[model samples]
Target: MNHSNLKIRARDERILVIDDDLGVGECIQCMLRIAGYESAFVTTAAAGLERAQSEAFDLVVSDLRLPDRSGIDVLRALREAGQDTPVILMTSYSSIESAIEALRTGATDYIIKPFNNDDFLYSVERALDEQRMRKENAMLKRSLKRVYSSRRIIGESEGILRVLDMIRRVAASDANVLIEGESGTGKELVAQAIHYASPRAEGPFVPINCGAIPAELLESELFGHAKGAYTGAVAASEGLIREASGGTLFLDEISELALNLQVKLLRVLQERQVRPLGSKHTYATDARFVAASNRDLKQAMEQGLFRADLYYRLNVITIHVPPLRERGRDVEILAQHFIEEHSRRLGKRITGMSPAMRDFLYSYHWPGNVRELENLIERSVILAEGSVLSLEDPPAKGTTAPAPGTAGEFLDRPLPVEEYMKEVVRRYQDSHSEMELAAMLGVGRKALWMRRRRWGLYRSGDSRREGTGKGDLKRSA
Candidate 1:
C-alpha cells in the first residue's frame, strides 16, 4: 500500500489515539501527524473519553484491552454520548467472539497489533471513507428537508384537498404510487408531499425526470454504473436507487422510458433489487417508488408507446391531479397565496387583486394548470403598479385571462395581422359572439371565422366568454 497516498485522507481530519502504553500512543500520534493529520495521544480510557467528548475528532483509534477499561466500553460510552465518529480498534490477538462484539458495537474497522504500516493505514483509510459517506448522506437529508418544507402543497379546493387526503392514506404504505396529470399540475409537488409525509420521511427523496435525460443516459442515472462500465466511465457511483434506499424515488414522466429500460425497471420492482449498468452484483433496494406522467400511460400502452406490464407495475396506486381549471376556487386561493409569498420576496406592499380579477381567474380554462397560475401571479406582483393587482400591469393582455385596459390600442392600430388578431381574440373571446367579435374588430365575419379555425382558440359549442350574453355581438364588420 502507498503510505504517501494515505497522507491526503487525514489532512483535514482530527484523530484520537487511545492506549496506556506511552510508546505505542506516541508512535501512532507521530505517524498520524506526519501523514498530515492532527491527532492526540491518551494514556487511559477515561482521558480518551474526556478528549473525545470535549473536542472534535474525525476518527478514533483505541486498543481493545485498556489498562482500566476495554475499548468496547469506550466505544459504547462515546456512542451513548451521541458521538458517531468512526473508530478503529487495535488488538494483539482476539477471539472470534471478541472481534464480532467490536463490529456489532459499530467499530468501523480493526487492526492487529504490530500491524504492517501499510495495513494500519489501509484500515484507517476505510474507516474515514465510511465516516465521510455517513456525514454526506446526513447533510443531503437536511438540505432536502429544508428545500421541500417551504414548497407546501397550497390548495383548499375539493379536488386538491382530496388529493392531499389520498396522499396521506397511501404515504404510510410501501406500495408503488402513480401520479397522472397534465403537465404543470404540480405532479412533482405531489410526489414530494408523499415522500415528506411518509414513514420513511427521514430518508432521502430522489427525483429524476425521465423525459429530461437522454435515453442513452437515463438508465445509468436511475440505476447507476460501475467503474469502467462504459466509455467516459471514470468511477463507480450509486444511482437514485441506493441514494433513496430508505426513502422514495420519484420518476417523473415515466411514460418516456424506453421499453427495454422499462423492462429492467419492472424486474427491479418485482425482485426489489437493482443492478447498476456495467456492474455484476445486484443491490437490494427498500426505496418506495413514486412515478408520475403527464401523458396517459394506458393510452401510450395502447399505441405501443409504453409497455402494459410496466404500466401496471407503476399503477399500483394511482393519483390523478385535476388540472387547475377543475379545482374550483383553488385558482383564487393560489393567486392570493402567491401574492403574499412573492410580496414578501420582492418586498412589495401588494395586498390582493380585484374581485372581478379573482372571478375572472376562476372562469378561464387554465390549460397550463397550477404552474401557469403561479407564474402569472408572480409576474403580476412584480410588474403590478398598485397594491391591488389588475390585468393591465405586466401588460398581461391577450392571455387566457381578461385584459381590461389594452383594447383601444389593440383595436386602433394596424399591428401585425396575427398579433392583432390574437390580442383581439384574447381581449374579447370571453365577452363576444362570433359575429359581434368580428364587428368589433372591423373584420369580415368570414375572416374572423377563418381565424378561429386556424388558431383553434375555441370549439364551436364552447362558450367564447364567461358571462351570459349582456349584449348581442355585432353581426356585420
Candidate 2:
C-alpha cells in the first residue's frame, strides 16, 4: 500500500505490540514505522509484559486473547506494576465484550480484528497525543514549582532569614496566612513561595489584587456570575474561589476589600464553601487561603475600614516582610543583583556601581523598597556608558555647587514644590527621556508634558542622551 500521503505526527515514539499471531504483530509494527514511530513486537503476553516492565515505551498494543494470559490480565499487571503507558487492545467481533471490559479496566483504545489501517492509526495517534499532553503539563507544573520555590527568595538578612524559616514551618500546614508589609515589599512573592512549598504545589496558585479591581466588578470576579445573572452575562461562570479548589488562593491587599465582600469572604472561610452570584446553591471548596496587605488590619478594624472577624480568620499565621531600609547590607546585595540582571537584559556591560554611587545608595532611604531599587538599577543600566554604573542626574556627595544644568543644583536653594519640580524637569530634560523624568517626579508622562507646556519648556535639540558623557563628576571610583 502506498503511504506517501500519510501525515506523521509521531516523533520517534516507542510502541510495543503483543500478539500470539506473528503476521498481525508484524503488520502493526510496520504501520507504526510508517507513522514515524519506533516499534517492537512480542509473540506472547508474558514476553510483552516483561519487556514493557523492563523498558519504557510510549504506547502498548496487545491482542484481547493470548495463549497463556488474557489482555485484561496484562492491563491489571501493568497497573499493579505502576506503569501508566497508554494501551490499545485488538479484538474480534466475538470478543467485543472482552474488549469493552478491557477499556473499562484502563485500555486507551480498542480496535476490531478486521479494523482498517486508517482507523487503527487514528486510535494510536490519539492515545499518543494525550500521553504527550500529560507529560508536558507535568513538566510545566514542575517548572512553576521550581520558579516559585522558597529557595528562590533572594536575601540573607536576619529579618529575611526569619521570614524564610516561617515560610518553611507554615508551608506544611493548611492554615490561612496573612503577610503584612509595605507596598512593593515582596508580599506577593512570599505568598507564592508558601504556596509552592506547601503540599498543594501541584495545584493552581490563583492570585487576585483586591485593591486593583473596582468594588462593583470585584464581587463578580471573586464569586463568578452565572449565565444571565447580569445584563452582560453570556455564560455560566465558576468564580476564583471555586477555580482555586484543591489549590491556593492569594488575596493581595486584602485590607482593600469592601466591607460587604469581607463578610461574604468570612462566611466562605468559616464554611469552606462558596456561593456564586445569582446561584442559590453553594458548593464546597478545598482551597488554601493566603492573604496579604500593606496596612495594619488591627488598626483598620478599629477604624471600621475592615471587618474584625474576617481579619481574625485570615490572621491565623502572620508573616511580616521587612522594609528595605530595615534590611541592612541587603541593599547593596540586591543592588548588585539588579545591576547584573538588568545589564544582561539590556545588553549593557555594567559590572558594578562606583564607590560614590554605592555610598549614595547606602545612605538613601528606600521608601519604595526593593521594587524602587530594581527600577533605578534598570534605568541606570540603560544610561550607563562604561563597565561601572555612576550617578549622573543626582550627583554624588562633597560638591559645593551642583554640575551645570542638573537638578541637584536646585537643591542648594529653597524653592516651592512647583518651582523645584519645574527646575528638576527643565535641567534633566536634556539628559533623561520623558519616561525617566516623569518617574523621578512620581507623575505620568502626560502629566510631565502638561507641566512642561505650562512652564514653556521643551527639548532644545536631541535632548535625549544615549549614555553618561563628560561633566559626570566621578568623585571616587
Candidate 3:
C-alpha cells in the first residue's frame, strides 16, 4: 500500500449513521467526530442503504428502530447486496430480542440506548477494527493467488470476460472444469489460470493431449504401467493421475479419447482411484480434472463416439473460450503482446505497429485464433527492417480490403489468374527488391524475371538487373 494513503486512512476513518430521529443521528455523529472519525447521517433506512451501496464507509452505526424499518432489515439487505462493512446497532433493553437478532444477522455489536460515552466509543472502535481485519484477509487471499501464478487470461473482450468470470466462480473449489474452443484459441491457458488460483495451487499440474497420443497408449499413460506390463515397459512408471496427486490434471482435446478409454476415465472420476496395468493394487488420487476440446462433445456423444456419463462428469463447470474473430479488438492487444515478446527474442528494437496494420488486423477473420496471430507476428518481427512494424510485412490472405497500395490489395478481390499475377509483379516492382516482390506474389524470382520479360514490363535501361517497367502504371488502377 502507498504510505500516503496509509497515513490518511489511519487518521480519518469514515462512519455512516442511520437513524430516523434527527436527534439520535446528530448525537452519534458528534460522538464519532470527537473520536477522530468523519461521519454522515441519513434519516431513513432507504436513504442510508442507498448511500452504503454507492459510497465507501469504514463502519455503520444504526438505531434499531427507524420510521421505515428496523436496523436488522438494513443489515440483512446490505449483506444480500454483497456489502461487508461492519455494522453496530443502537438498541434499548425493552427490545433486547430485536437487538439480539441484529447481532445474529451480522452486526458487529449492539450499543445499549442511554449508554455512556465510553460504551459508544468502545463499540465504534471494535467495529472499525473488524472492518480492517476483513480488508486484510481479502488482500492476503488475492496475494496468494498472484504468488502461485505467472500465467493468466489476458483478453478484455466481452466474450473472453464471460469465460474468465466463470473460472473465477469455480476456481476456489475442486469442481471439474471443461473448456471448449477452436484450435489455437488458448484453451490450456484458461486451465492454468484456474489451477493456479485454486486451493490446490501448491500441488503439481500435469497435462496430456488425448489427440496427440495413440489411443492404445493413452490408458497406460493415465493409469501408469507396472514393470513388464507392456512391450516397452522397462520399469515401473507412475502415471499422470498419480503425478497430479494434490493438484490438477489438464486433458487437452478430450473429445479425442476413445470410447473404451472414456469409460475408464469415468471410473476414476467416480471412485477417485486408479489401478496400474498389470497390478492388483489401486492408488487413490486427489487431483482436480480440467478438460478442453475444440470439437463439439455433445455432437460427438449424439453420434455415439463419446460417452455421455464421462461428458456429464467433466463438464460440471463449462467455459467456452471465444474465437479471435469474435473477441472484438483483442487481436490488436494480443498482437502487440506478441510483437514485444518476439522483438526481444529476435533482437529487434521495434516500438509499435502502424495504424493501417492495426486496422487490418482488426478487420481480418483469424481462423487459427490467437496462435495464428502470434505466429504471424513472430514472422513479421523477424523480417521487419525498421523500429515500427511496416504495414506491408504480413502475408495477406482471403478477401479482406487491404490498405491502399499494399500487395494485399491484389489478393483481396478476384481477377483473371494471369492478369492478377502480372498486376502483383508490376505494382510492388518498385518499392521492394526483386526477391521481396517475388515472395509477395507467391512466386520464385526466376518466375518473376520471366513474367517481367513475358509482359515486356522490364525497365528499358537495365533489362536483367532491375525489373522496373516502361508502362506508366497510373492508368491501370
Candidate 4:
C-alpha cells in the first residue's frame, strides 16, 4: 500500500518514531512527512528516550520490542522523567501482552505489526488527536486559574479585601467553610473561588441551592439512591456529594434545610459517609463542604428553625461579604464598571454619565447591592437613546444628607441668599427670558424684572425705556 498519500493535518506537530528496523522507521517517517508532520526516526530505544527527554514532541510512536530495551521500559522512563508526550506502541501478533503492558505503563495506543497502511495512519491520527486535546485542556486549565486568581472576588473595599484574604488563607486547608451574606451579595461566587483556589482545584465544584429542592428529594440528591429506592426510580445514580469527591460541594441557602435533612447532613459531615435512599450500603465521600446562608444561622438556631450542631460543624471557617451600600466608594466604582460592561454588551457607544446622573448614582442608596446595581446599569444601557444618559428623576432625599447637627448649623448661618440669587440670575440670564424666570419662580414678570434690577443683573436684550418701571426705580439707586 502506498501510504505516502496520507497527509498530517497539523503541520507544526512534532512526532518521534522509534523502531529497531531501519526500513520500518524510515517508511513511517516518510509517511508522516507526507502527512505534513515534522518527524524524526530513531532505531534504538535509548536514542528515542534521549530525544524525548531533551526535546518536545507532540507524539511518540515506538515498537514494542527493541534490540536494547522494550517500549514498556521507554514508556516508564518517560513517565518517571515527567515527559507526558503521548506514546503509541507497535508490536507483533505474538507480543500483544507486551503491548498491553506498555499501555498500562502509559502508552496512549497500540497497533499490531504487518498492519494495513490505513490502519497504521488511523492509529497515528488518533494518538495525535488525543495529544492535541490534552494540550488544549491544559491551556484551558491555565486560563481558568488566571481568571480565578484575579477576578474571583469582586469588590476591593476594605471589608471585601479582608474577606478575600480570609478565603485565600482558608482555601489551602480541608476545613469546612460557611459563607454568610445577604442575598445578591455573591455568596456562591465566594464559594466557587474558594474551591478553585484550594488543593482540590482539579476536582469538581458542585453547587446546590438547598431551598430550591424539596425535602423528600433533598436527601436523595445529597446521598445516592438505589435503582428501586422509590416510585419512578429506574436507575442507580451517584449523588452530588459523591460527584464532588476530591473537590467542594457548595450548599447555597443552607438555612432552608429541614431538621431531618439537617441531621442527615450533619452525619455526612461527621462520618464522611453517605447511605443512599433505600440502599442497604453506604459509600464514603471526600468532598470538602462549603455551605452558604443569607440568614443568620445562629438566630435561626435560637428560633428553633435550624440545627445548632450542624451550624457549628459548618462554621469552622466563616466569610462575610459586606453589602454594596456599606462598601464605601465601591458603589460608584462598581456602577461605572457595570455601565461599561453593559454598554459593550448592548453595542452602545455611551460616552459617560451626565452631572445629574452622576449625582444621582452617588447619592442614591443601593438597597439590593452590587447585583441590583448591575441590573439597573443593564437597563439604562438598553434604554439609552443618546450619548448622554438622561436622569429620570433626582436621587431620593436623605441619601446624601450631612451628618446630624451639621445641617442645622448650615441652614441657620446662611448669609448670602440675595447674593446667591444674583449669581443664579446671572448664570441663567443668557438662556432664560424674563417671562421664563417669572414662570419658574411662580411670580409676575414685573416682579422678576424688579428682582433682577435690585440684584444689578440685567440681560443684554432688556429695554431702556424711561418709564417708572421696576428696572428704572431700582436703577435710580
Candidate 5:
C-alpha cells in the first residue's frame, strides 16, 4: 500500500504482538512501525490477553507456545471476552493437526516459522483488511437495529405493516417523499425510519417544523443566511437544507408554508441550488426532501392556498400514515409498548394493563392520535402502584364513560358535535382552574376568556361563574 493510505489506516489501527521470543516480537513491532502501523508487543500471553480485553485492537499476532498458556487458549479467552480481532498464529512445529487446530480455534492464518519478510507483511495486511470489513459489517447491523426498533414507529396492525413495507422499499431510492397523516400521528418517526434505512444512513437527518417558525425567518431557516442578512445576523449560518446535504430534510406541517416561500422551495427542488439570504452567490445542495402535513394539499390547491406545482413536486412518492382509531387492536398494542417503555425508564415494575384500561384504549376515538395515547400511557405507567395498570378514568378528553345499560360498556355512542363540545367545555370547567384549562386547550388566557364570551358560558365581569351549563348536563346525563 501507498504511504498515505497506510498513514490513514494507522490513525485508527492498533495491533498486538505476543511472543516469548524477544527477537521475534521486536522484529514484528519494528516492521509494523515502519509500515505506519501502531502496535504493542508483550512477552507473555497473560499480558497480551489483558491488553486485548482492556483495549481495542485491529489485529493480533501470537506465537503458538507461550509461558503462561497455549496460543489456542489465548484465542479462546479473547473470543469468550467478545473480542473478534483477527489473530495470526506463528510456530516452528507446523504439524497438520496443530495447524488445523489453530485454524479451527479462530486463527485468521497459521504461519510456519522462518517465514520471509514479504510473506509476513502480506499476512498482516490481509488480517487488518479482514478486521476492517468485519467492523464495517457490525456497524451496518447496528444501524439496521436502530431503524427497525419499535420505538420509532409504533403499530403492528396490517395497515401499519403495509406502510413499513412501503417505507423499506422506497428507502433505497432518492425520491422526494410526501407523508400525509393527521396531526400527532408520528409522521416524523416514519421520516426517521426512512432516512436511517436508506444508503445515506450515516448522514444527518434534519427535521424542521415549518409551522412553528415565523414567516419572516422561515426562508433563512430553510435556505441559510449570509453574514448581516437581517437585523440580528451576526455571521453566515447554514440552514437545514445545507446542513442536510447528501442526507434527508424533513419539513413537518409543510402546508403551513406561505405561497411565496413555496415558490422558492420549488425552485430549490428544481435547480438543486440555494441562494442564501443577503447573498448573491448560489450554492449547490443535494438534500432529499420529505414533506409532511395534516392538511389536504389537494384541497389547499383547489382553495388557492397552496401552489399546484409545488404540491406535485413534493408528492412524487407519497405515504399515508393511518390514524390510531383506524388501526383496530393496534391501539392496545401501542399502549402496551408505551407502558413498557415508560415503566423501564421510570424504574417501575408495571406488569400489564387492566381489562377496563384495555377497553377504554380500544374504544376511544383518539382524536389526537398516537401522540396523545403515548402521553396517556406514560402518565398511567408513572401513576400505577401495583402490577396492573389502573385506567378506569381513561384520559381527560377520551369519551370512555360507561353507558347506562351495558355491564362493561365504558362509554355510550359518540355524541353530536355541539353536545360533545359542550361536554368537553363542562369537563374543563369542573376539573381544572382557568389557567389549567387554557393550557390544556393550547390557548392563551385571553383567548380562553374570549371563547367564554362567544359561548356565553359566563358573564364578562364575574370571576366565580364556573358552573356546568344545561347543554353540558344534558349531554353528560
Candidate 6:
C-alpha cells in the first residue's frame, strides 16, 4: 500500500489482532495504522477472546495456531455468542482444507502468513465493505416496515377505523385477500399493510396492475416465459409469481383481466404452481395472492367479463375500503396531513389551511377519493404564498351561496367552456340528478359522470360516485 498517497483521516472501525508471535502482531498493527485504521493486538487467543466479547470491533485478525487455543475455536465462540464481527484467519501453512474450514467457521477471509501489505489492506477493505452493505440492507428493510405499517394509514373516521381493524385481524392469516374500493382509495396501501404485518413481512411484495399490461403479454408477465418463447424473447425469466415466492403477489385491477387469461390464473391459484410460457416444466410457488379492483367482481362475473371460478379462488377474504366522501372528518385530517407532508418536502413553512378552505374541502364531494385530495393539497401547498393555505373560490355574488352568482358570472363573461360547465354544475348539482344534469347539458349520462369525475364534482352521499342518480343532492355543491 502507498502510505503517502492514502488520505489521512480518523477511521473509527476498530480491528483486533490475535497472534502468538509478538513481532508479527506488532508488524500487522503498524500496517493497520498506516492505512488510517484503529487496531489493538493480544498475544494469546484467550486474552483476544476476552477483549472481543467485552469491547466492540469491526473485524478480527487471528493466527490459526495460538498458544492457548486455535483461531477456529475463537471463531466458533463468537458465533455461539451471536457476535457477527468478521474474522480474518492467518496461517503459515496454506492448505485448501484449512481454508475451507476457516470459511465454514465464519471467517471473513483466510490469509497466508507471508501476505503483502497491499493484499492485507485489500482484504480488510473488502470485508468492511461487505459488512457495511449488510447493515445498510437491514436498515432499509426496517425503514420499509415502518413505512408500510398499519399505523401509517392516516384516518380517524369510523370507516377508516373499520378498515384498520380488518387489516390487523387479517394480517395474522395466510389466506388470499381481495380488496374492493374505488380508484385512489388506498387499496394498495391496505395490501401493503397486510403483507408487512404478516409472517411474510420479510418476504417480497410484488405488485402488478392487470389493466396496465396488454392481454397478449400478461400471461408471460405473470407466469414468466422461457428463452425464445416469443419474437422479443432472449433470456428465460422467472415471472412475478415466482418472484413473489414466500411473499405477496398484489394483482391490481384484476377485473380488467381477459376471460381466457382468467382461467389460467384460476388454475395457478388452485395448483400453487406456475408453468412459464413455452416451458414444459412447472415451478411451485408459495406466494399469497392479494387482488384489488374498483369494479364489482360479482357483477362482472354475472356479465361474463370476469370468471366466477377465479373470483372465488382469490376471494378467500374480503376488505372493502370506503370512499373519501364517506370518511367525513377524515377529509380535513388527511388534508392537514398532506399539507404538512408536502410543505416539509417542498421547503415551505405552511402552518395550516384557512377555515373557509377547510370547510370547502369538507363539503366538496371527493370524486377521486383520497388521491384527489392529496393532489389538490400538494398543488395548493406548492402555489401558496402565505403561511396558511386558502382556496380560490368562485366569485360569489353573496355569502348565502356562490352557485347562482357563479352561474350568472359565467353568462356575463366569455370564459372557457370547461369553466362555464364547472360553474353551472357547481350552482345546480345540489338540486339536479345525474339524468337531469345530462339532459340539461345535452350529453349522455356517462359523459356527465366523466365530466363530474374530471372536475371532482360528485354529488354528496355518492361515496363510490356511481353517477347513476343514487346520490342525494340535498347538500350544497
Number of the predicted model whose lDDT against the real structure is largest? 6
Residue 238 lDDT (model 6): 93
Error of 1 at 374 (Å): 0.8
Ranking by lDDT: 6, 2, 1, 5, 3, 4
Which prediction has more favorable lDDT, 3 or 6?
6
**What order do candidates take by TM-score, descending?**
5, 2, 6, 4, 1, 3
lDDT of 2: 0.79
By TM-score, the best candidate is 5
Candidate 1 global CA lDDT score: 0.79
- Residue 422 displacement in candidate 2 (angstroms): 19
| Number of clashing residue pairs, candidate 4 | 2
Q: What is each predicted model's overall lDDT from 0 to 1?
A: 0.79, 0.79, 0.76, 0.75, 0.78, 0.81
Per-residue lDDT, model 2, residue 399, is 23
TM-score of each: 0.59, 0.62, 0.55, 0.60, 0.63, 0.61
Root mean square deviation (Cα) for candidate 1: 14.6
lDDT (Cα, tens digit) per residue for candidate 5, span 1-477: 122323323546888999999988888887788777899999899999999988888889999999999899889999998787889999988899999999999999999988876678789889888888887886877477555643578678888998898888899899999999876688889998888888777678999988878888999999899999999999998888999998899999899899999998999999999998899999999898999988899999999999999999999999999988789988988878887889899999888887867877777655457876776777666666677776543342332222123312322456543344344455545445565444433333554564565576653334434353332211111
Expressed as tens digits, the lDDT of each residue in 117-173 for candidate 3 is: 776776777777778887788668657765544334667799988977787788899
Query: lDDT per residue, candidate 2, 207-318, as tens digits?
Result: 9998778898899988887788888889978889999988999999898899999999999999998888888889899999999987789999999999999989999999
Which regions of candidate 3 are displaced past 4 Å?
1-151, 394-477
TM-score, candidate number 1: 0.59
- True lDDT of residue 339, candidate 2: 86
What is residue 102's positional error in candidate 3, in angstroms?
Answer: 55
